[model samples]
Target chain A: MMPAALSEATPLLSVRDLTVRFRSGRETVTAIDRVSFDVPRGRVLGLVGESGSGKSVTALALMRLLSPDMAEIAGEVRFDGRDLVALPEGEMRRVRGRHLSMIFQEPMTSLNPIASIGNQICEPLRLHLGLGRKAARDRAAELLAMVAIPEPRRRLDQYPHELSGGMRQRVVIAMAIACEPRLIIADEPTTALDVTTQAQILDLLRDLQSRLGMAIVMITHDLGVVAEFADHVQVMYAGRGVERAAVRDVFGHPRHPYTGGLLRCIPDFDGDQDRLVGIDGTVPSLTNLPPGCAYAPRCERAQDDCRIVVPDLEAVAPAHRAACFHPLEFAREVSP
Target chain B: MLNYIARRLIYIPLSLLLVLCAAFVVLRATGNPIDIFLDPNHTPEQADVLTARLHLDQPILVQFVIYLRDVLRGDFGDSLQFGGPAMPAVLDRLGATLELLAAALGVALVLGIFGGIACAVWRDRTPDFLISTIAIAAQSMPSFWLGILLIQIFAVDLRWLPTSGRGDGWHLILPAATLAAFVLPNFVLITRTSMLEVMGEPFVVTGKAKGLSAAKLLFTHVFPNALNPILSFLGIQVGRLVAGSIVTETIFSWPGIGRLLIGSIFQRDVPIVLAGVVVVSLFIILANLIVDLLLSINDPRIRLG
Candidate 1:
């Protein structure tokens, strides 16, 4: 509808102040507190966070998948020039699977056990694309082949339990990409898989992203995955975004102490170390988070100001941002 | 699939043999049928003649062996009360019982499944509260009391249906409704619970994310997975319903196996009672087997196993 130049300049997904609060009895706990980011067209944005850091909640909110009875979401999620936050449910559903899709963590439980893989893959094609039964089946077979599943035709009639874990995940990916969505939200897609399978899946996702030019929001707790796959990185702590920058900048010039702690937690295979370094404390409970920065309690750099007031996510470098008053000044090189 | 069915079919006769042995021992332990069957003024010589003729005078083990041989030959001996073969009499009443059972099952499944799905879909809302309250109340009410109440309302005052005695479809209304009322609650509760659980499964979320309509998600995904537990429960309910029909049959005066079994027990008609036990037990066993088969077909995991 608009001029082509402005549309080309705009990111594929632009999220601003996305907040999610879950209600239990009388108390309300904010799971995602005013987090924001942008994913440029065809780029991969890594959302790194520990458990309870609101990564999954943010993903579900973006998709409008969270149950309204349990969660209250407020924010702007502008995707492809449409206001997704304010879209009606019926309209949102149309956006889902057709233009925006999601790949879940546990492929074991993601697919319907009773349904054939073919039918599962065919569902979205038939739903959004309006493909007939025979057409859907043919498209489904092509999709299975695209995901690198062996014997795609025979595998179509196979149930979930008949397939191995890796194959099932491939089938799930096949389903996710069936309609050739413009964006895919992969929430820890490889966490449940073995190391070899994880690499294969990442490779497949990377290959698919470039070939299809679909923006990807890769949500995970693994920094290694970010280093390997993401072009940009956003680090979250206690339901808030603490750092946002390009993958190379965030890794080389680690700004937030929490982000540094995460990078250090990964075992150094070349170095002489007896044990792996872990962040000292657990993520604070959402209902009882500190008034100041939620990570201040666990941060070694905490000061009087850090305990008294929260710091806003401000630019540290040209594009790098971190929400910390005492961010590291010097850049430390870390090769991917 | 055929191999699985064959394996199950092979168990039927072995299970029936075990039932027959238990029945023979328990029936003999109830005391000789001669004492209850013979007239009080009958001569001692006449009683002795009857006992020997019926094989009651022989050792229990010898009588059991003779009984097994006769049963293997499809001869259940004569019903002392009916003065006919007990098997035929029991079989004759089976059709009526099966008819009542089918009607009652139809009523229960239709109302119960729909009610359960409603309760689940509208869970924690006014409709769920209302349906759950009604289901609990219905479950608690005895079948006989319900039958009597239905008779009072529909037959006595309203004059819409016959009060008792099985005849045409009109006579079936009250008894079948009563029997169904007792079981319908179980179906509602089970289906609701199963549906709730299945609706929470990850595949359901996947279905939702696929932008499938709510009804499509429910019918194609949730209901199918939920069906396994409901089917298993249905198998168990069939056994209970067959036994439960005794009270309903007696109240409604429906000439079913339950009524026949009740009359035989009261009159100490050993042959008829034994025949009824074997037939009912066999029916329950077969119903359970069919349910297991259905479950295997419905779930691939179970099928492959």
Candidate 2:
């Protein structure tokens, strides 16, 4: 489980002050608040959040996949030391499949319903790699075989409707790794899948990540998924990062009350059932976010100033930071 | 499949029986058949003698049974006006209408589908705007008016094409274009709408995630998935085109069944008129069945008991 092909130092993607906005009639809604993060080579950065927290928006913003009239974006996104924000559409297309790739959460609706699994896998190679037709087809078969699809050759001629939801997602993963990109932004990749399939997909992703030495941004709402996969973690609320730290530091000594509430919310496998706790209030509407720290309205430890003053990301310990007016008490040991 | 065929076949007889009954009842029930057939100057006694000679003296039940029996045997008597066997004339002209409808539907399918896919892929682009505008404009105009306008422009003034007739000569261009223009918009619009919906699915992004380019995505993905709902639209249009060909055929002076039916209606030749309706209805039903079969194959959801 040591870093295999990756060097110890090298950040593959840098997102800086990326802002995305939507306009409805006369009202303007900023979907993604100015956000920044770094994904190191061969590292898994788990982006944890509740729904409508702009976790998916951050991933979509990287690929420039938002609709033309819907999204207004401005900010710096640099991948492999190259600025992606200002690149022309033509050049960005070349970069999308070759140097960068992404997988969506829904396995069912993600594959083209009419195209054969093989054709879907071969698309990037044919477009960007410029391999000859026979070689591209041969590589497509190889990809299916690598993904462990049974009878890879016959699958080449079979359409997407013939495959189950799990197989279709496997096809999607095969296509993602076809070009062996430097960065793979898998947005809630296992959320739509069954429990057993989710584990297999996670394992496949991790195996491929280490072998390819690719940086992965695993965005999810599930804290349990982060525990199993993420080496580093960033928790977001109201489109802003509230806490970020190593996985050990994050769950072991919970600094932010939001992070503490989130960790307590999860049902422990080996614990007294009565001890499990959940935050009471629902997430506030992004269009009408609460004043001061967005979590203050829901935080039981909120002070008078916490309702008026915003908290910036400040270090609680080495390589650990939280945005909170009052930090939580860290137990001597994690609850396991 | 055989049960379906058998069920449909049963409807054919049941349909013809009703038509035969209507023809018999309406023809005689409205007025004295012999009186209408004979001179008005004749006396009542003369009219009675003439009716008796013509077998109008027979009991109504006896007449109906004999009539139904004759019709079942395909001895549809001569049209009072045309003085020819009804079945042969109906069958001959049904062929002509079928040919026109097939050609028109063929043209509509090719142009509508490809144009729709193009418009959806380039939505909000100039070409998409242009295709949609043309389809809407064509769809808004009456087919009869469109036919007249096309005749005036291409056939009468420009003289580059013939006015009418389905022939080896340059006669098909205008009428075929007339039918196609009417059918094309529904096809294009349905396709465009469905294609837009399919394009919006998260899977298209998945396809993009797989690194598919514009051309491959449209043909392989967008076009096929969008094709499902449009099958019903296409079937409905085929039936409309068959019924609609009456106006087009009349305007163009084409000797198809529509023109024949109009002539029969003028002559009070009810048998041939009924035959025309029957033929067109059969064609509509058949086209729909074929379309349903194709749809089941495409979507894999629809199946028969």
Candidate 3:
């Protein structure tokens, strides 16, 4: 594997020891527990996690979208030489659309329904880039064309309801890329779309990333998507990342039992198994997390001590790390 | 869209016919109009002549047909007290009612919508709580009582405004305020509720993520998106306000159609009362029709024929 070290310039986005907690009533619930990762310039980082695993929360935290009064955030989110966690809202506003952007999960609802598609696309450009009305409008049409939306000019005047699901997702992508932000965070961008549409959107994202040379934080539970697009993969469990590695290393040598369990759940094309494998237990609740490793209760290779002691994310290989008391052996690996 | 509008339009005449028929039957059931005007000196022959002259001696069905035909011909008969065409009398008083409606609606909309927006933006905060409480209290308060309360405070006690009657803008204050109080709560509640719901929508999140200021996000994305439902709601409320002006006008002695209608009822002036009812009904229906058209115009998704 390549060294994958930080080059001379700063990483596009670097998050370290990010913790998020909510004070509801008298209890303090941890939403994101010491989560950390980095996205190098122009590379894709796939954050793989199931529901309640802090994937979306992390994205919201990065964008400072969560209410500060409600959610207590403690972390260092350094991007382009500034600590986003410490930035004031006014300065944060400038960084948001101009330097960073996000695409949401549901295309059906992720647009202002009454707003014309063209106007919505032109909004960020006008606000961030200071483009004139005619110029922004023209640029919006170009973006639509870039996303392969047919009759881009006409589609601009149409409302979101007039467009198909795939078309709406494309429009969402067009909005995210409007300002040419250095980084884009897309959370489950294709979960609401059909399989065919999902593939098209993923392809569009890949094409845009290469052409624009922008980093992407692709958050999804679908490993297949990560394998196809991401350079690095981070597997999160119970509000914290349990594994971090290059996409190939994580897939080829899944050292953590939870990561191995996730990989085993994926159906193989040539395997003779009639039923697919699934992990035994559900993700732990935020307010009632176990004292030990969050995935220990569900780990097949769990030891007695694993139930009492939390595991640190220690290095298992070059550019590969996993949090597990007893790491998985390589003999059970399924080649990607 | 055209088909939808045409279909809605076709229901109007049918509804008017029903209302006309109902009003005719109900008015006759109330007893003889001539008996109320008779003095002890009047002989039975005089009563008969009066009854025949007014076509009251005819069969009920015949009278109804004549009434319908006359109404179609723009004749609403003569007023018993005023002794002129009842239609013209009612039409003359309509201006006062319209003025009250305009002022009331203007206050209700401005206060209600802005207050609702404030509540939604600061939901669960102190301002939200205060505004919501006021809205609830206003909604529950009857217009008659509210009018008296306004008169008691501003007219009787403070002497800052007139107790009753409409001449200048100052005289309109109490009545319009009472009516506006009745309407304001609904606007506040609906706007707050709808805006809160829309604020939770994914697009709102997208707007925030796009670095839009709170004000821009609200007016541009949240408020506009939340407006269609409120517009349709406002249409219904406006139509209701026109009809509801009866009580407000009577309490304030504002010389509107409502006050005139009540006086005609006490006088057993059937033609005048019926004319007033029909005119007011027509106004309400027309207002609602305009509202429907406006709703369609505001929302492109709502196509009109």
Number of the top DockQ candidate: 1
By lDDT, the candidates rank as: 1, 3, 2
| Tens digit of per-residue lDDT, candidate 2, span A55-100 | 9988888988776578887788977767788877667788887878
For candidate 1, the C-alpha RMSD (Å) to the true structure equals 1.8
Worst 10 residues of 1 chain B by lDDT: B31-40
TM-score of 1: 0.96
What docking grade applies to model 1? medium
Q: How accurately is candidate 2 docked according to DockQ?
A: 0.43
Which ten residues in a row are the worst by lDDT in model 2 chain B? B296-305
Q: Which candidate's TM-score is highest?
A: 1
Q: What is the C-alpha lDDT profile of model 2 across B51-132, one tens digit per residue?
A: 7755677899888887777666766656666668776788888767777777788899999998888888788899899999
Q: Under CAPRI classification, how is model 2 graded?
A: acceptable
Q: What is the interface RMSD of each candidate, in Å?
A: 0.8, 2.3, 1.1
Of candidate 3 chain A, the 10-residue stretch with the lowest lDDT total is: A1-10
lDDT of 3 by residue, B1-305 (tens): 67767877898888789889999878777877577656658899989988987688898789889889998887877877988888888889989988999999999999999999999999999999999999999899998899998999999999999999988889998999999998899999999999999998988889989999889999999988788778778878976787568889999999998889888888787778888888877777777787787777656666622
Q: Can you tell me which runs of candidate 1 are displaced by over 4 Å?
A: A1-5, A330-336, B43-52, B56-59
User: Rank by DockQ, descending?
Assistant: 1, 3, 2
Q: Number of the top candidate by lDDT?
A: 1
- Return whichever of 1 and 2 wins on TM-score: 1
Model 2 alpha-carbon drift over 4 Å, by segment: A1-9, A131-138, A273-275, A329-336, B1-84, B91-99, B106-140, B145-174, B274-278, B293-297, B300-305
Candidate 3 CAPRI classification by DockQ: medium
